[model samples]
Target: MRSYLIIGMCVIFLIQYFLKLQWLEYTVVTLSLLAFLGSTLKADKFPRWLGIIMMTAGLLIEWNKDTGIEGISEGIFLILPLLSLITLSPLLSIPLRLGGYFNSISVLLRNLLLHPKKLYAGISGTLFLLTPILNLGSVRIINEFLEELKLPSALSAKGYIVGFATAVMWSPYFASVSLVLLYLNIPYKDYIIYGIGFSLLSLVIGNVLFAIWEKRHPLTKEAGVKVPLEKQHQKQLVKLVFFVILLIGSCLVIEHITNWSMIVIVCLVSIIIPLIFGIVSKRWYELIPRLVDFRDRTVSMLNNEIMLFMSAGMLAFAMKGTAAANGVSDFLTTLAHQSVLLFAIAVMVIVLCITYIGIHQIAAVGALAMQLNAVELGISNISLALLLLLTWSISTALSPFSGLNLMVSRIAGVSGVQTGLRYNGLHLFIIAVIGIGVISVIG
Candidate 1:
């Protein structure tokens, strides 16, 4: 059953991509709605009210656009549910775990954290020297400190989770930036250097500010928990290495094949690699039961309010397709005076606003890029990419609604809202300083 479902999804995706079945979008959407509704009705574990609300919200979005029966038939409705599925999938767990492992090197990490000042300086220095690697490494180190020191779990989680944003700040290697670079036919190395300079400044400034703030309002000290030294260490290590190789390799592969979107590549690797590794062992028949389990668990964990937001995305996308959203791009361009500073600030503001409204960073960044590209603004492609990267990194770092935040919160046994808010100021400061610096230099 699971294989069939996955195969079906793949087939549908292929049809959408290759056949350009604008009409099939309605069918996709209708099925997605049905699945959402059916899952909500049959599941007892998750927040049913939330599911109903999401379904209702999706319906409202469809109605507002006057998408009508044709929209439903065209598979527009499935967009939200499918997007939700991809966003909320276990596949993402691979990256999360990779991030977690790099963060768990206690002794080495503690040596750095002991001197916060030095650590911050080193990170800043390395930002330019090692832009491609610093963000991921910095987060891992911070996470190790948080976990080892037994700081308030919420604070610890925030520190580690926010690291993702830091990495995204100026890293040219980031998929989001890479995509924009590819589209514009810009040199990857030049943009990466630009990103590095901005990222380093942000990291240093952000961490310093955060450390000072914490010193003034010290969090309640948490009791140190025993580290799991022996039991799962080897297993964890193996998984971590595998994840790193996969992530790096995925990027390289995509760089070579610019025709395929990053998401498709990620999805393919996620499904295929695990099977090949026996991480998901075959008694191939067992796959169905696992998928059923997955669906059940996912449905049970449903927060229907998420659907309303997703519905908004569908509406936006649908409108964009039909030209209803063209005005939005025009409005954005008009607000800017073509001055690099003004355009940069405007892009940041727009991304921030969209993020605040519960939109995912990936979607927001992609949408903004497309709009910006359409206008043929004088903004340098590298600068635009940098701004988009900053927006995405900051938004993802600060949003409790993000999957990364939710997962971190769950793992640390803390509230997602609390985690998001705790790190919000720090992320903004980092992005502002670093983002501005990169834009200025590139522009």
Candidate 2:
């Protein structure tokens, strides 16, 4: 029942893209609030409590201002598109999963990435390429393969997870990048001009860190099963690469022609490409059952995310135009005028600190973004977008409470805090110095 409500919300949101009806948007907001209520009992303790607090604060603020119920509803509706993007984007993995190519690719990776350092690069590098399309699903797939290959826990944990973080820095498919782009109102092409460079640099920095860490704790025997890489698996690996390029390429081409937002383009491409693949590959028979299974399982799995993001939308609404927001804007403006470098450092520090204490990056970024003015900060909108992307990547990598870290902890048998502080803590220092340099140069 709750799943249906969420699905209905997404369906209605899609309709609004073409129809542009006010009633359709209201329907989405209504369904979203209902879904949030239904999922609250099942959501994780932290998001559950945090959602309640944020919702309460938002409602109280609205009440004090006498904005009435309609005004409050408008606030919640403001971020509904991002929610739809998040909900629908994960469906793209279903066709690939059902096709069984994942097994073939896994076998190929295991046979190839035998040495410890090479394994680290392979794990992180594969995830870097795939995470943009698969999101958290990539982490689960890689970690499942790692369970059979016996590398040290640290190598397994940091390699793939950090790779996932690097993708978040630039990928239009990620909620982090989409949200920042939506807020800043910049074209995806403009942001990607700088973002792709930053992401590539971060990927190299992550691999270099692995090299240093490898010296301290070396693996004597080569990891992974040493079976011959089969021809079929090699073909499957090539097919996977083709699929990623096709999907992302389709999005870029369509966005250029249609001028749709990246999130909407991703949502549409995620669905259309899979169906087209099923038909072309002669696997049309499998699509129905797989899609049904995906719908049933995916929404329940997203209970926490649904609740948290809906409430975050409400809080973002309440925060705008408030005295607190004005004060933050004033302070940030002054700090930027004093020294733009410090302003850049301060942005990353604030985001990292907030996320460290169990606040989701979405919530922190959403709130902090409201308080910022790009003109006053002496930064271009694209540069500001890159700065936020850097912070999102770093904080998501290091925040134990972040969805990525929590997922990694569960798969790698490492505590969430340990995954962040123990593995990525030093990496964070190196990234900070490099990130500030990049921001200084660009901003």
Candidate 3:
């Protein structure tokens, strides 16, 4: 039954891509949601209220003339990370434990010293480092850090939450970069290397700017609160490490042997290998049930709303088959002809804005790259790809609405609005300056 649903979803997706039918695309999304919900129900973990919310949102989005399969696809893509977050409990526990130790000490010392700036920065920075280690790692670390430091729980949590909006700027292992590279037909290694540089720049500059800002405007202090840590059985930690190492090794091997997309490779590792191995295990009953439970929970949280949003992409693609969204590209090209440097700046700014408005960096960057075909721009593919990489780094790293940002925020116990308002402008400025300089050297 699951296999049938998977096959059907893929067929529908392919049909939408090839035939571009709005109604068919809508049906595809609807069926995909049904399959997801059905699985959740079987697991007895379905959240009806959240499912209703997703359905309503999907309907509203579909009602809009501009919303289609293309839009819906983008929506689905954007929500993958969000869904990943919901399912990350099993995966994130280890890193969180490791980072929590440091958080606790930082929080306690800062409170004792009565240095709010240092306290906030210390907690935030520690959580930031913890983010790339695991899914909910940052949150676990921050919560523990706050408790150990004897700082107010609200302040510590809020600071940790805000830090999520910034961590993706540095974490190269994130799914966003992987997705963008896949969509754009770019090499993952190129993105990984370039992203490392961009991520470091964004992190350093963003932290410095935020630190300076805090010195200028002080907020009220609050009392600390304590929460119990989720204990990880030693066996689970060992197994988790084994799984992660295996997955990473598989990716590197595939990257060497085939030019197939990183997303495909990731899905194979994240979803397929586990399923196969679990079935083969003597403890299949236990392992399979747990894996299914994780998948159902993740789908329940992320799939419905994303499927609804993806319907928009279907609709858009239905309306215009071969002609991509060229408005932004045309605008950029006109500016590029005037000066490549200006073109690079304009692209970064546009990507930044799109990201702020809650668009995923992959979609924003990929769509822009598609529209700005190198053939049309009289630029080498490598150069255009590099520019896209830079823009992606800036947008994904800085945008509070991004998946990485939201994940960090949730873990840190803060709202996206708070994080965005606090860090967006400063990160944007730094990325802009650094982007122009980097592009000049590369060009």
Candidate 4:
């Protein structure tokens, strides 16, 4: 029931984008409200309870100011695109899984890299490049391959976690990037150069750090897996790479021509590319059944995200022009006076602290972004976005309660806290410092 409501909201959003009908807009909000009702009770305890509290506070504040119900409606509508992205992006995984794309690539790589160090670098490098396209599916694919190896859990965890988490700094497909872009109202093209540059810098730094860590904790002789690689798997790997490049190029061209929001464009492309591929590859017979399976299983899994984002939207709207919002601006402005670097650091620290306590980083970012005045802070919208993106990327690796770390912990056979704080903590700090310097220079 909840899945249908959420999926219906996404469909209406896509329609409303093209039609620009006021009636459809209201219908989207109505569906959103119904979905929220289910999520508030069904979502995880932390976000579910936190969302309720935030929503209640937002409503009270709006009512007190006499903006009444209309203001509340507008607030919920503000983040509808983000909610749509979360619900729809999972559709990409369907084709990749059914087509055996990741499995083929992982198997081919496993057979080719027989040395432990070579395999480590190969896995990390592949994951870093593919994560922008595959998202968390990239990590799961690599982790499954690693489990068959005689490698230590710590080594494998470090390799994939850093490799996968760093891409969010710039990947347009990442929810973090989308959230920052929406909050700042900065175009993707304006932000892409810095995002890509900083991400490559972070990747280089990660590789160097991983090498250093590897030297101390060396792998045993049995770490290598020698198996005959199939020709078909190699062909599939090449096709997968070509398709990823094509998908990105297509997205850029369409965004330029249509001037649509990146979120909408990505949602459209994600759906279209797979269908086209299925037909072109003569796999059309399996596509509908796979999509139906995804609809039933995956759409229902977004309960926590749905509740948190909708509630965060309400709070962001209610706080606008309020005294509380002004206080946040004033605080950030004072930090800017000292040094813009300090302001960046302060923002990252606040996000880190909030996420460390088990709350998702999106809520922290959504709440603070409403109060951030770019002009007063003496930074362009693009610069602030880069800083926020860095924060989001770093927090994902450091926060034990984060879905990324939790997933890695489960696969790596270690404590969740160890995955974040013990293994990746110091390395993330170094990357954060370097990232801040790059943002300051570019800003």
Candidate 5:
């Protein structure tokens, strides 16, 4: 029954995309709230407290304007499509796992690993390349390999956090980029162009800082150990690279020809490409049961992420309808008049501060987007988008309550606040300073 209802809601969500009717959005979103509650009661799977808070806050904020019900409901409706995409990601992950391609490369990288620095670079490098296709699913692959090799937990954790954050800034497929694009209305091409340089700089800076930090580690001396790659490893890696390029190329071409948004293209191409490969390679039948099991189990992982963002979207809308929101708009416009540099700095501060208190960056972005979006602050859309992306990435790395930090904490067997938050505080500060400087110049 639960599965059936989930399917029904997804179908309605798809229809709502084309219909674009407010009433339909309200109906589906209301059903989603009920479904969340029903899932807890029916399946013994409670919604995360964050989700509950988001949904409730969205309602209260909207009620302040007499539109909380429909407004928040429609907000849920907006994000449900993304929820469907993320929860359904295992459809791609399962095939990659079964094919032994990603794992083979991961194992190869591990085997060739020398010292802390190489390991840091290797792990971060692999994640940077693979994250576009694998999303968060890549974390488990990297984690399992690191554990098998008895790698330093902090090294791998820091490497992964940086790599993943860097990738999310520019990846057309990432929810960060997608959400920013949705709100900013910037061309995806422009986003990629502006972000590529900054993204690479962030990744390079992070890995270099990580290497410097490793000087205190005992294994820094072992970085030069000789390890040779076998012919088979070389072959497999090349094939995997080609496969990734193929997937990316297809998505880019389709997006260019159709003029569809990158997220929409990503959602479609991620499914189509893998499905065709599975069938053509004759792995579809054998992988079907495993895929089904993965879906049933892992789809629940999205509950927190989906709930937080949907609720944030609702509150953003609710805020938009209020006189206070109007007042904020006027104030921000005044700031814009004072200086674009100041406006950009203010945005980073607001986002960073809100995220520090366990509020999702999206909530901050959504809350301020309307006000900032309407102002002509001499900042390019791409600049604002990149700033938000970097801020989101940095905050998640340092926020103990962030989903990624919590997950990394569990994997590293450390306190989320102490290890994930305190450990990365210095790196985040550097990023914050450099990032704001760059935004000031560019914006």
Candidate 6:
């Protein structure tokens, strides 16, 4: 029953976004929150309670403010990322499993192991490159490899965080990009170009900082042998590489021609590419049943994301009609007037500070990027967006409370604080400065 309900929401969201149906979108958004609220009531421990608090605050604030039909309709689209991921997740898992991509990763790692001197750089670079293709799936693969080697968790956690965080900073398919595009209302292609440039800058700085850390605290024990990717996997690996590129290229072209959002475009291409691949390779018959079997668990995986995003939307809209909104806007405007460059730097620090206190970066970013009104920031919207994305990715990476941080810590077998902050804090700060510089240069 939960499986069906989850699947139902996924379908509604795709339909709602694709058709641009305001009424239906809000209907689905409302339903999704209610369903999640029901589940939260039953299981109050862990991060589940965070969503409940957000949802409750959203409700009370919205009740007083009354964001009518239109505001309600607009807020509904904020869940686009959740819905897009759901549609893409099952479709994506099929290729990672059946296509050579999964095994190809092991092959790549094996090669990295051969060049032991460059191993950290190689692993970090590989993760940054593969994250858009694999998302958290990359973490699973890395974790499996790390666990087999009996490497200490703390050693690899910072590298993993850097790799994955860079992916979120720039990828068109990442939720951060989707949210940025949603509010900025700009061509994703423009942001993609800027994002790529800044992301590279951040990576270069992060890797150098990481190398320094490695020098200061060398690995205590040897990383034992890893099995290399074999010939059979190599044959499929080429095919996997070709298709992943083709998939991304096709989505960009289709978006250009149709003027659809990246989320919508990705959802469409993710489904189409694999379907065609499965059929042409004569694997559709086998693949379809396995994908169907996996649906139950795959759909259930969205619990936290759906809850936070939907409630955040409501919270954002409700804030618009509150005095607190004006106060925040005024403060930001005054700060911006003082210095856009300094303001950008301050934004990064504030995001990290707030994250330390347990506020989700998404909540703060959505508020900053979406709700702040009438601030004479003297920064180009694109520059502002780059600043926001930089802070969002870096803060989330360093925040122990963030989903990404917790998952990485769990998989790497380190405490979240150790991995998320103790190890990566200064590295992330340097990256933040680089990110601001990149934005300033572009502006």
Per lDDT, the best of the predicted structures is 2
- The number of clashing residue pairs in each candidate reads 18, 0, 27, 0, 0, 0
Model 6 has an lDDT value of 0.69
Q: Residue 48 error for model 3, in Å?
A: 14
What C-alpha lDDT does candidate 3 achieve relative to the native structure? 0.51
Best by TM-score: 2
- How far in Å is the alpha carbon of 186 misplaced in model 6? 1.6
Q: What does candidate 4's lDDT look like per residue over 271-335, in tens digits?
A: 88778868788886788887887688778878877877787677767777788677767888898
Q: Show model 1 residue runs off by greater than 4 Å.
A: 1-7, 14-27, 39-89, 92-150, 167-246, 279-309, 319-328, 357-370, 399-427
User: Whole-model Cα lDDT per candidate?
Assistant: 0.52, 0.79, 0.51, 0.79, 0.69, 0.69
Model 6, poorest ten-residue lDDT window?
A: 110-119
Angstrom error of the Cα, residue 208, model 3: value is: 3.5
Error of 6 at 258 (Å): 0.9
* Residue 185 shift from truth in candidate 3, angstroms: 0.8
- Candidate 5 lDDT at 39 equals 47
lDDT of 6 by residue, 147-172 (tens): 66655465578668888888777777
TM-score of each: 0.63, 0.95, 0.61, 0.92, 0.89, 0.90
Q: Model 5: what TM-score?
A: 0.89
lDDT string for model 1 (326-435, tens) is: 66577666654456677677777777777666655544665565456633665667667777777776776666766556656765677777666665565675557656
Model 3 scores a TM of: 0.61
Better of 2 and 4 by TM-score: 2
Which whole-number lDDT from 0 to 100 does residue 17 have in model 1?
58
Better of 2 and 4 by lDDT: 2
Q: Please tell me which model should have the higher lDDT, number 5 or number 6.
A: 6
Clashing pairs in 6: none
- Among all windows of 10 consecutive residues in model 2, the one with the lowest summed lDDT is 217-226
